[model samples]
Target: MIKSWLKEMEAEYRIEILFASETGSRAWGGATVHSDYDVRFIYKHHDVRSYLSLRKAQETMDFPAPYDAQGWDIYKAFHLLQKSNPGLCEWAFSPILYHDCQNFSSKLRRFVTESYSLISLFHHYIHLMDRNLKDIRGKAFTEKRQKQFIQAVRAFLLAKAIILEQKVPVMALYSSFSSSFPKDCTIVSFYQQLMEAKQSGELVSYADIEDAIFMMEQERPLLLELSYGLSKGKSIENELNQWIWELLHL
Candidate 1:
């Protein structure tokens, strides 16, 4: 179904989708039975002449649910890669893939993993958690707020993995946490319980997430210190530029 959707999008937009994958809860291993598909993709113009335009073309497309399709132009994708954009990195590492033209997805996965800045990626997830937590603060535990809490939890864990493990965290939350902190089964068990509550339509207790956030907050200084101690990532602009050219013109 999603493949056909991508085909329709390609025909309508006259672009080649080089990579497409699931994002959001679906990709993160926390999705419930009612979850909608969140498809993210990267594309290049089928006609390279579009790149020669004086007026810039739109570099992104966003469609509404149930498909909830969104994509970046090749240039935009490369720009995000250059910044080690955590969202783009998740697309590369996503366990669920819909398209991977010319093995572009694997190429991107390896590139970001090898070159992403530890501090940048770590800070990205940390800030993400903080922002989401702020948005839900003083709010009732409605379904929307419940989702936000889960996202915050996931972000906090991912950031924790990055600083402590000195690696780009994996896309799936449970697997990433379990693998990164194999001895710490308590947090993993708590996460499982949280997910069960979420899936069962039970509003998870606010205190549960609050405690987790408090624990994460206590580790911030150590994570920051560890982040700086990790290697500064290499420059990837030249390589990414070359890769983009190949994708668009080859």
Candidate 2:
């Protein structure tokens, strides 16, 4: 269904789809049965003249629908890549691919993996985890709150990976990034149970998981300390330009 939709969209807009993938909870391997598909893609104009025109081309598209879909123009995607945007990095390395024309995603993933800024990704996850932590701390427990708590945990794990591993966290399973944590720790045990509960449609209150939340709070300082030792990555603009040339001609 998604592939057909992409074909239709490509034909209609006269754009070449570089790649498309599942994102959000499903891409992270943390989604429940009720989770919706979040489809994102990268594309470029089929006509090279569009790049030379005086009028600005649309850099993004958000479609309403039977399928939740969005897209970024390749130029905009490379611009964000140069800035080491964590969201773009995730899309580049997303585990589930719906479309990958001429292995475009693989090429982009290699660039992102090698050159994405450590500090950018580290702080991105840090801010994300912190915001969700606030929600978990202050909000009344409900299904929405439970989702927020899960989001916080996922962010914490990814942030922890960035600071310690010094690499893009691309694993589909967020729990798989727990190598730094102790093998039999409360965090690990709680995460496993929490995932099972979420998948089973079980309702868990804030009180039920308060200790684990505190554990995450206590570890925040250590992550910051590790982040201090990270190096900012190099520029990929020249390489991205080469990609633009090659992709345009292909």
Stretches of candidate 2 exceeding 4 Å from the true structure: 172-181
TM-score of every model versus the real structure: 0.92, 0.93
Candidate 1 lDDT, tens digit per residue, 7-60?
999999998899999986777667788888999999988877788889786699
If candidate 2 were superposed on the true structure by all CA atoms, what would the RMSD be? 1.8
Alpha-carbon lDDT, every model: 0.80, 0.80
Task: Report the Cα lDDT for residue 23, model 2.
Answer: 79
Off by over 4 Å in 1: 171-176
Residue 183 of model 2, lDDT score: 71
RMSD list, candidates in order: 1.9, 1.8
Candidate 2 residue pairs in clash (backbone atoms < 3 Å): none
